[model samples]
Every structure is written in structure tokens, then in C-alpha cells.
Target: MALILVVEDDRLVRRLVREVLRAAGHNVRTAVDGRRGLRLLASATFDLLLTDVLMPGCDGLEVIQQAHRLRPGMPIIAMSGGGQWLKPDKCLNLSNRLGADRTLIKPVSPQRLLDEIRDLLGA
Candidate 1:
């Protein structure tokens, strides 16, 4: 099982993801926003980061940039609900540019999420 960090501003989403990852046998850690996510990244080691694309504080792209700088090849999976104003494609493209290993739209199935994570991490 991989150690997964889940970063999301929405409380419900965060809880769901944490529960899913834990149930999948992953060691899970969570942060409510990008800033806290970055702090966690600095303090602990995780096999992957699963973060929402848009957040209240620092965005997922910025978090990806910072995390990449800290851990050059760390894997990241960025997700987005598109937030009314933003497009999913735009978020996916930006996440790709920022070095996310993969991107997923919100409301993704738990099995699919686990599959993507495994595929990216090659586990």
C-alpha cells in the first residue's frame, strides 16, 4: 500500500477521499488547503499527493510546483469539479503543465481513483 496525501478544501470531499484511500489499504494523510498540504509535504514523506485543482488559499498547481521542487519525482494526482467558472479541461491542462502525474474530474469512482493512482505510481 502506498502512503497517500489528500488535499482538498471541501470538508466532505476530504473525508470521503481519506476514507476511500484508507479502505483501499493506503496510509492516508489529509490537508484542508494547499498551504497546509505544502506544510505536510515538507514534514512527511508520501507516495502520492491527490489534490483538488482550485482551493481557497494556494492552488493545486502552485502546490504541485512547490512539491516538485521539494521532491523532484513525487507523483501527484489533481482533481477538479470545475467550480462554475473554471473548465475541467483548463484545470487538467494546467495540472499537466505543473507536473501532475494524472488528473481526474470530481465525483470519480473510488475504484477508478485507485486504478489511476496505481497506474501512475506503477504499483
Candidate 2:
């Protein structure tokens, strides 16, 4: 099992992801926003970071950029529901440019989430 950091601003989604990761036998930690996520990253070691694309403070793209600087080779899975502008693809492409290992759409199935994580980590 891996140590996964879930960074999402939505409380319900964050809890749901926490539950899913826990059910998959992975250790899970959560941050409500990118700033907090960065703080957590500075203080602890994690196998992966699963973060939402859009957030109230320090968006996921910025988080990815900063995290990459702080921890090169750290795997990141960027998630989005394509809020407002319906630009999921654009967000995903940006994530790719920022060096995320993978991108996942919101409302993803638990199995798919686990599969993507495993694939990215080569587990």
C-alpha cells in the first residue's frame, strides 16, 4: 500500500476519496486546499499526490509545479470535473505539462482510481 495525499477543496469529495483510498488498503492523508497540501508535503513523505484541478487557493497546477520542484519523481494524479468552462481536457493537458504522472476525471470509479494509481506507481 502506498501513502497517498488527497488535495481537494470540496469536503465531500475529499472524504469520498479518503474512503476509497482507505478501502484500497492505501494510507491516506488529506488537505483542503493547495496551500495546506504544500505544507503537508513539506512535513511528510508520500508516495503520490491526488489533487483537484480547480481550488480556492493555490490551484492544483501551481501545486504540481511547486511539488515537482520540492520532490522530483513524486507521482501526481490530477483530477477535475471540468467546472464552469467545461475544460477538463485543457486542465488535464496543463497537468501533463506540469509533470503529473496521470489525470483522472472526477466521479471516477474506485477500481479505476486504484488502477491508475497502481499504473502510475508501477506497483
Candidate 3:
């Protein structure tokens, strides 16, 4: 299994992702926002990064940019649930343009998430 880092501001979403990854036998680390996510990246090594695009501060795009700058080959999966201010595709597309290795729409299924992780890590 891979060591995965999950970054999301939504507590419920973050916990759900962490638990899902754990159940799949991956060692999982989580951060509440991109800032904390980056800090975790600096302090530890992870096989994959799964992050939500929309956040209160230092959003996922910044995380993607920094993650690539720090580790160009690091695999990243960017996710988003669109809101009144932005559409899901808009943010997710930008994430791809920036550096995300993958983009998943919000409400991602456990199986799908696991599939992506496996595909990325060759698990």
C-alpha cells in the first residue's frame, strides 16, 4: 500500500478520505488546509497527495504548485465540489493545468478513489 496525504478543509470530507485510505491498507496523513498540507509534505515523505481544490486559505492549487516545486514527480489528485462562486470543472481543470496528476469530481466513490490511488502507485 502507498503512503498518502489527504488535504481538505472540510472536516467530514478529510476524515472520510483518511479512513478510506486507511482501510485500503495505506498509511494516511491528513491536513485541514493547503498550508498545513505543505508543512506535512516538508516533514514527511508520501507516495500520493489527494486534496480538495476549494479551501479557506492557501487552497489546493497552491498546494499543487508547491508540491511540484518540491517534488516534481509526486503524484497529485485534485478534487472539488463546485459552488455558487465557481464550477467544479473550472477549478479541477485549472488544477490539471497547474500540476495535478489526476482530478476527481467531488462525491468521489471509495472504489474510484482506491482505483486512482492504485493506478498512480501501481499497487
Candidate 4:
């Protein structure tokens, strides 16, 4: 129903998200990290961006800022499964302030993700 870019460092998470969205009829593309995500984003157009907040090279926050600058009205959902040093909720909070249209903690249910996407897409 929409072109979505899923940006996450964890391979399993990225694959799961892509598969779920695809199964639901979305055209889903994915990147392994935020830098790759930005590269893909720069070269193409996406109706929504679903990204993880923590990554090695670049982070979701940077991606969000650049994505917003590149496509001002693009809807963004930032997700995080924070490590020992950080908290998922705190990361999500920061992402919200940085202009994420929505946020989710990791281990998000597929149905919930789809529901949020439907709401964001006004479907």
C-alpha cells in the first residue's frame, strides 16, 4: 500500500520487518545501517521511513533529520532496542523530539507496526 524503507542494523529484525510489510502489500526496501539507509533514501523516494535509533556508522536521528530535510512531509517511525548503556524509551523520546512522526520500542508486534503504518498513511 506504500513504499516503506526499513533501516535497521540487526539482520533478523530488518528481514522480519521487510517480510511483514511486503506480506501486507507494501513495497518494502531495507538497509542494514543508517548510512546505507541514507544512501538509499537519497537515491529514491519512500512514503515512510521505519528506522532503528542506534547504529554504528550513523544513527536514526541523523537519518530522520536528513530525511525530513530531503522530504519534508515524509512520515517517520523510529524504533529502538537500547543496550545496557541506553534505554529504548529514552531513545524513542529523543527521536520524537527530533521529528519522528511515531516511535516504537523493539520487539514491536507485526500487527502493531502495520496499524501504525495504516494510521500514518491515512489508509
Candidate 5:
């Protein structure tokens, strides 16, 4: 099992992701925003990061950059449902460009999310 950090603003999505990962035998920690996510990333060790693109406090792009700075080899999976101004594809593309190893659209299937994590972590 691997340790995972989930950074999402939506409560339901965050809980669902945590449950899914735990069901897959992974240890999961969650943060409501990227700011907290970064703090957690700095303070502890994690095998992967699952973050939402658009969030309050700090955005996922910033998180991605800082995460890379903090742990260059750790994998990052960026997820977004699209905000009022940006489409999901655009957000994901930007995330990829910034440093996310993988990008997923919101409402992602539990199986798909798990699969991506597995691929990233080589689990």
C-alpha cells in the first residue's frame, strides 16, 4: 500500500476519493485547499498527490510547482471539473504543462482514478 495526499475543495469529492483509495488499500490524507495540501506535503512523506485544479487559497498549479520543488520525483495527478472561466480540458492541459504527471476530469470513475494512481505509483 502507498501513502496518498488528496487535495480537493469539494467535500463530497474529497471524501469519495479518500474512500476509494482506502478501499484499494492505500493510506489517504486530505486537505481542503492547496495551501494546506502543500503544508502536508512538506511535513510528511507521500507516494502520490491527487489535487483539484481550481481551488481557493492556493490553486493546483501553484501546488504542482511547489510539490515538484519539494519532491521532484513524486507523482502528481491533477483533477478538475472546469470552473466558470476554464474548461476541464484546458485546465487539465495547463496542469500537465505545469508539472502534473497525469490529469483527470472531475466525476472520474473510482476505478479509473485508482488505475491512474496505480500506474503513477507503479502499484
Candidate 6:
């Protein structure tokens, strides 16, 4: 199993992801916001990062940047439900531009999410 950090502000979403990954046999850690996510990235090692794009205190784009800096080879999957101002497609495209290896629009299916992670990890 791989160690994955899941950064999401929405409580339900975060819990859902954590449970899904755990059920799939991945060791999962979570952050409520991007700042904490970055801190975790700095302190520990992660095989993959799965993050939501819109968050308070630091968005997923900045998290992706810092995570890349901390571990250049780590694969990142950016997700977004979109806000009133920005659409999900735009958020995902921006995430891609900022170096996220993959982007997913919410509500992401558990199977699809697992597939993405497996593909990235080649597991």
C-alpha cells in the first residue's frame, strides 16, 4: 500500500476519500486545509497527493507547488467542485498548469479516484 495525503476542506468529502482509500489498502493522512497539508508534506513522506482545489488559508495550487518542491517525483491529483466564480473545468485546467499530474472534478466516483491513484502509482 502507498502513503497518500488527502487535503480537503469539506468534512464529508474528506472523510469519504479517507475511507475509500483505506478500504483500498492505502495508508491515508488528511489535512483540513492546504497550510496543514504543506506542513505534512514537509515533515513526512507521501507517495501521492490528492487535494481539493478550493480551500481557505491556502488553495490546492499552492499546495501542489510546495509539494512538488518538497518531493519532485510525487504524483498529484487535484480535485474541485468549483465555486460561484470559477467553474470546475477551469479549476482543473489551472491545476494541470500548476503541475498537478491529474485533475478530477467533484463529485468524483470512488472507483474513478482509485483508478487514477492506481494508474499513477502503477500498482
lDDT: which candidate is best? 6
lDDT of 2 by residue, 1-123 (tens): 999999999999999999999988999999999999999998898999999989986999999998988878889999998878758888888899989889988889989999999998889
| Models sorted by TM-score, best on top | 6, 5, 4, 3, 1, 2
The reply for model 1, stretches above 4 Å from the true place, is: none
Cα lDDT tens digits for candidate 4, 11-88: 999999999999999999899988899999998989999999999889999999999988889999999998789999
lDDT of 1 by residue, 1-123 (tens): 998889999999999989988898899999999999999999998899999999987989899999999878889999998878889889988999988989999889999998999898898
Residue 73, candidate 2: Cα error in Å is 0.3
Error of 3 at 115 (Å): 0.4
Candidate 4 has its poorest 10 consecutive residues by lDDT at 81-90
In model 5, the worst 10-residue window by lDDT is 114-123
Candidates in order, TM-scores: namely 0.96, 0.96, 0.97, 0.98, 0.98, 0.99
- For model 5, the superposed segments whose C-alpha errors exceed 4 Å read none
Across 5-60, the per-residue lDDT of candidate 6 in tens digits comes to 99999999999999999999999999999999999999999999999999988999
Q: What is the number of backbone collisions in each predicted candidate, taken in the order shown?
A: 0, 0, 0, 0, 0, 0
Q: Which has the better lDDT: candidate 3, or candidate 4? A: 4
- Model 2 segments more than 4 A misplaced: none
lDDT of each: 0.91, 0.92, 0.92, 0.94, 0.95, 0.96
| TM-score of model number 5 | 0.98
Model 3 alpha-carbon miss at residue 14, Å: 0.7
For residues 50-108, write the lDDT of model 3, one tens digit per residue.
98999988999999999998777989999999768999999999999998999999999
Q: Supply the global lDDT for candidate 3.
A: 0.92
RMSD of each: 0.8, 0.9, 0.7, 0.6, 0.6, 0.5
What C-alpha root-mean-square deviation, in Å, does candidate 2 show against the real structure?
Answer: 0.9
